[model samples]
Target: MNSWIKLSVCFGLCFSIAGCSSLSGMFGKDADYRKNEAELAKKLEMPPNFVLRRSGDPLVSMNVSTAQMLEEIDTIPSFRAEGIRIESNLVERWLVIEDLSVKDVWRGIEQFLASQGFKVEERRLDIGLLTTEYLARKEIAPVEQELTMISRLLNSWRDEMVDGIYDRYTVRVEEQASEVRVYFSHHMMTARATDTTTAWRLRPYQPMMESLALYRSMLYFGAQQDHALQQINTQRVYQEVKEADELVGLRLAATLNESWDYLLTMQYRANWQVERQQPEQHLLWVKIPQAATADQGFFSRLFGSIRTPGLVGIKLTPVSGSTAITELTLVVEEGNLNPKQRQQILTDLGLLTE
Candidate 1:
């Protein structure tokens, strides 16, 4: 038989009436088809020891639980994996995939970049470094929309007239044991023209863009662990424990590393700026700003300088046990607070004591 005839026969045999949605989930753009794909994507949750198997072609497989089936979905990217986590550093947000090898994450990143329309400028798998070509994208301004349709239409058009910006990024992947940490750095560029030619010049660094790209990449990683993480009971209210004569600041129902990450995440969520952090010594110095007064509007609260930011001292100590738990201690260096009031402050800031 001819090659075309044999291929056609194979496809016809693979896509039977019972398995037609599998094919349409990939190529079909209709509303119902896309909805089906989104539904399938939502049902996918990878266990920590998940395995992928492919015999011949995955599209022809009848198993609904196959990893290949989930990979075929073309929905918007997300980071909903079981062991994936997003962390904020001094200037950037990063991804930490637990129990995954560096090689596995490297491939996932390459696939993610290709799916996001990024052209790979360079790649060194040995060094776990990837660089992408500069991409030009329009800067969109946030538009406030009125209730009326005409008002919303005008605002939408106004958003289109916003300025353009270019960004280039470098990603570094570091492997620790069975886990990998991915960090991103963004470099901005501006258009420059002389009498002869137009070129792009590197602009000053924009930390905001670095954060934005990191978040967008998190979506591309599609490893959301929110539900599973919540079910793990690894988070807990802070507690004051007496270790000998010293009163420990807090205690957590997590390991030492988990406690550190949780503390950093909590600080980031609370908008507390880190002044100094020493992981080796388990100490962090952060500027905790006072709450905005009722008179301070949104713009003022966002743009104004911190008038009475307090310098807080945080320390962590791991308790010895099979189950991971850590002791956290908090102290105010420049404020006057009694023990009762200090506990109250931590409680008011969502650091509950049990």
Candidate 2:
């Protein structure tokens, strides 16, 4: 009876150890996950019409231009792919894009202005002019450096309101020889407060703001951020001859070719009609309307009997000694022009060279 009990106990112990081993094997550390992952991926089914996209070529030959590469890819050429630079002088600044069509530049400018939240008040496709409505906004608060607790508390208590300012921009696009130039002009209005009331008054022109706009436009047109910033910071100084109050001619630090282009651009900006161009003689015939009828619409001029327009002659002459300098003079041919009229015409043209 003792032997039978001992054997039975041994058998029970062996069975209990074997059962524990079986349980551990069933619920132990997981199997190789990498193999399981491969199996799962193989078993998974892709959705219908699914196509894997491949990467593009990582290397391009140095001889191939960006436009050529775009062509090879069957992609439309954009301003970003074209050569772009900023040209500025004391009085004006403009963006120059090479190998781009005027239509492309015009479309890009429109898109850029729209993206910047500017409402187009006027646009003339024939002359490539765009004017935006006044964009009103509160002035930005001045940054405070190393503020103290008391100062912070006082600032918090203050209303933190800022005066309102309005900004309007004018953009002109001109095609020069093989390049397209974009000009930006800015006007501003600010709120003035007095003891009795506050009113909006015309503010002085801000060239810095115009430069910033040009910088932003450069980025919009596909210029590299660093390159655009560098171009904006780089200043090009042109020698300007300040004429006496009596003189009517304007001196420009540009070649004859450049002056001709500038004159064309001025005509567009001033809404002057060019009767004819004498390139050989370096003369441009323009018709200037009187102030009374200057603001009249095309139909009004067409239907309404109007006074004869003043015929003005513009002469471009190269400076005596310098090949890069040109002198622009105005001569009234048919109608008499007062000093103010001649001055105004010169002033409008002077913007390009000023």
* lDDT tens per residue, model 1, 1-354: 699999998888876754765555567555366777799986886442344434545344545554665575654344334466666422235677886578877877887777667788999988889999988766665665545877777666545544345777789999977678988777667665668987755543454455455555555666343533332222234446765644446667667787787777656544556899989978888764433222224323433553333576778888776446687777666654344444543543345422
C-alpha lDDT (0 to 100) for residue 238 of candidate 2: 38
Model 2 collision count: 0
Tell me the whole-model lDDT of each prediction, alpha carbons only. Answer: 0.62, 0.71
How many steric overlaps does candidate 1 have?
10
TM-score per model over all chains: 0.40, 0.45
**In terms of lDDT, which candidate is strongest?**
2
Point out the worst 10-residue segment of candidate 2 by lDDT.
Answer: 48-57
- Taking the tens digit of each residue's C-alpha lDDT, what string does model 2 give over 228-275? 988877644333334465545667778888878877775665566788
